[model samples]
Target: MRSFHVSKPRVITVDKNPAYPVAIQQLKQKKKIPEGIQIRQVKYLNNIVEQDHRFIKKRVRSMLGFKSFDTATSILSGVEAMHMIKKEQIDLRD
Candidate 1:
């Protein structure tokens, strides 16, 4: 979350995971996240985002696992770039 360097969100929608509520509470108590932020435990709200990453998951599953964080980060970044290009989401010409 801190790595994104974005403004605090007003709401966070997550899957019905048992640990997420506890984790969010802990972050609030530690002042890492705002206390007033709303948490919604919805099953389908995340489907769109999850669907978008399905291709990446399928691609990485064959590799078993990455040996280093730096290598994983580099490879994942390239994968995402290629995905965007394939989807025509990014314009190649400057």
Candidate 2:
């Protein structure tokens, strides 16, 4: 939340996690978040964030199984690097 640049957000979308609203209330009391900022706990609203992971999930689902944690980490790192390159967020030549 600190990474976001909004001075005063009208609404904040969050999942149905119990701690989320409590955290928001704490922030509101501390003047971190606007007093009237709406905390939306809609379950389906989180699909927006999950949508980006679909591609990675699809690829992972096709794999038989990772040999170990290290293997999974290495493969995921490569997948992410490829994604970054395809999105032009990172230069592959670098």
Q: For each candidate, C-alpha RMSD in Å?
A: 3.6, 4.9
Which candidate has the highest TM-score of all?
1
Q: What is candidate 2's local distance difference test score? A: 0.81
Tens digits of per-residue lDDT for model 1, 5-94: 777779887888899899999999999888999988897785566678888888789999788999999999999999999989999998
Error of model 1, residue 42, in angstroms: 1.6
> Using Cα atoms with residue i matched to residue i, what is each candidate's TM-score against the true structure?
0.73, 0.52
Error of 2 at 51 (Å): 1.9
lDDT of 1 at 33: 86
lDDT of 2 at 58: 76
Q: Name the TM-score of candidate 1.
A: 0.73
lDDT of each: 0.88, 0.81
How much is the lDDT of residue 75 in candidate 2? 93
